[model samples]
Target: MIDKVIEIEPLDDLDFGKVTAELRSKRREQDTIVLFHPSDSCQENLHHFIAGAKKIHGSMFDYGVNWDDLIWDIRGFESTTSLKDLTHASNVLFTQDNGKGPKIKVSRKDEVPFAEPFATFAKAFVTHRHNEKPKSHSNHMVAIKALRLLYQELPNSLTPCVSQLLPEHFNKAISCAMGTQAKPTLYVTGVHLTAIAESLDEYRLTATPMTWKNPIPRNYKHGGASQNRGGKEAKKERAKQLPKTDLLLFLAALWGTYEEIEERDKALVCMSIILLLCGFRMDEFIGLDLNCIPSREEYDKLPLEIDPETGTLARILRIRVLAKKKGHWDEKIVPHCTVDTIYIAVERLKALSKPQRLTAQIMLEEGKWNRFLEFDDDDYLTSREVKEHLGFPGASATNTISTLALHGIQRDPSSLKRKTRFRVGDIHDGFCDRYRERISPIINGFGHDELIIPIWEFLTLRYLNQYTPKERLNVFAEPL
Candidate 1:
């Protein structure tokens, strides 16, 4: 059964000024919570408001004012009071018995001329931003940081609002950021600003004020020419320092050393090999449940499928990995293992999976899981423990360096003089290079049309651009 149809106007179509007026009218009529969508954009707007308030009033702006608190405060404010009184009440809530507490008074003369417009704009902006598609966490963070910087540049006496923004303000803010951050970072910040402008434009709040020419060039080398040059030289040096033969010898030495150490150390080395071979990110494997490992039956079935043309065993083992970007599970087909390293590693982990060991593993994984895994894992493992296990980036680089030293290979001084350390990522790069070398001859012998399945699977797994061979080669050659 259907009742009378109630058609709600789309927020984008509604006039921003009219909507704010309606909201003000509603506040005057009733003191009740108004429902608003808790989208990322709305959340960001609330965050910006609180940050602006803090900058203006410091400790006077209550730290406990969340979304509901702000909503309720706005709704309950005395309609006849000046905007200054509303601002003061919103910033500082008094809970003492109404008349018994310190008598609070606000004068209309003390009010900033733009306070009312600011409040109206804030409400309208957030409402317009509501129910929007969510942006990535990294994108949201950049937006918040940009907003915070913009707020800091504003005079403390005035309330912050989107309408206050100007092209000059953005230019100045971006210029300040450029002093400390790289061009790529500035470009990313510019992207955040553009996103904000787009949001504002959708709401018809203000014509996007971000018309300033972006200082960072579109084709600008990410780390500058010198750094890029140094990176290529370092990559070559690493490749020369520890070629395939040296890498195998290093692994053998590591295995021999692990035999003398604890079971945990042995498990770590095995995991490291799996990570290198399978191209698994540290975060992907770190929190993996023991159940993720294939059973003996499953392992037995792995090599059953064979390619009709080449008579080569086809990939059958598939593992579910968590996609960090979308927060969903994606199936990653296990690549052809050149050796029995990953299998041995899986078995070692299974053998080491006692209740205490599982608990420790969970703790380590949870502690190490971060936005970029850039933070120190010292809380989970000590420097010596990390070195012994070859877990951290620094440890991996040190292992390679030390292994090269043992082989009487003279390490290039330039390789060790970089800001970023060599990591398991370097090993992944080398793996891709080797994989390409191995596959190129096969592709040359048999046309790509004949080996389409293997080629497609390989390209998909590696996240390579399917249509562009140059892009694929670049990705394969580039050090992650």
Candidate 2:
């Protein structure tokens, strides 16, 4: 075999090319051996190994030259100067695939004991082995075993000599890749080092250093666009439901008939509607006060309007009423009389819940009496006092909402003898406003006598008229 040098031209005048040129020039002058990694050894995939080499060179292996430059003389001569010849000379050893070469079969049972972790690292290693190829599902088993060996051996071989002798490129590549997952990231050799440390007194072991890279995209979505796992699924499912009109009626009937629910249920429902309609998060829902409710007058001034001349008279009449959220209320509303149900509901709820006014003398007397009152005096109400009155069941807000939504009865508080008479009225006001905004256009467009809507949409349409029903449902409903 003739030791000849072939000048490989630079692809670009970059820092990388400069580095390669320096290394090649030095190697040619000194005749310090240059090895071209073979394509036949289990580790012969030049692209994968080189990708890893490049990655490492950028980081901990900055002083190390890329193996690509050493292969200049062997580029076109496949039979004589190839990766196979280099493998025979043992200048380059691959991260073996089972006991077989590069294209061998991978067996699950033959995998390292920590199979999942081993496989995870193996995939990453193979990715580097194949020139950092985009990960695919093919031949994952082989990759797993190779990583297991790397993780098993690298760390316990001691510092100075062991670390110096080891290929820093291989070590760095393995460590960097492990950082990509949500696991106890074992450095390319940390786990192996720790295990080996027990048997040998010569080396030190440490966990893989925590490393990170920019996130890579994954196929988290299961199916089509909106039908995928998350918010899309919720939207799709909500769209399939018969519409809000019927759902609200059902809920209203349930509220009116079920007497078991106390004021707590009413409060929870109030918050739920506000969040679903308004796109409020859990914390926002919990923090709401009575003040957020909009006035009926303000609601009437919203942008929603219906043109009386466009559709059939009966059709126009049937669909003219619509719902509107407070934010979308604008000045362009025409034909003065669009009715807003949500605003009406809020006003009604507030009226029923308002405290009765007292004369000055009576208030003075009551205050004086309260000063001498005991725990059972029936005057001052503590947080516990209110909860007891409302029959609240839980310690935390999450549990409280969960309990109320599950078994609580819905009620129209504006009616006599119902704690939600206040909320019941508010619902009507809010619903009316939302209905005016949402329905009138569709009714004027299609000329329908009645409308069908989802319960969540009914609430959201009241608040913002922005989110779809499924989004509202996710905000409003718990897992149950």
- In order, candidate lDDTs are 0.43, 0.31
TM-score of 1: 0.44
Across 97-163, the per-residue lDDT of candidate 2 in tens digits comes to 3445444545645632333322223333432333322222222332343243444444433221112
Clashing pairs in 1: none
Clashes of each: 0, 52
Q: After superposition, how far is residue 128 of candidate 1 from its true place, in Å?
A: 8.1
What lDDT score is found at residue 123 in candidate 1? 36
How much is 113 displaced in model 1, in angstroms?
22
TM-score, per-candidate, Cα-based: 0.44, 0.25
Candidate 2 clash total?
A: 52
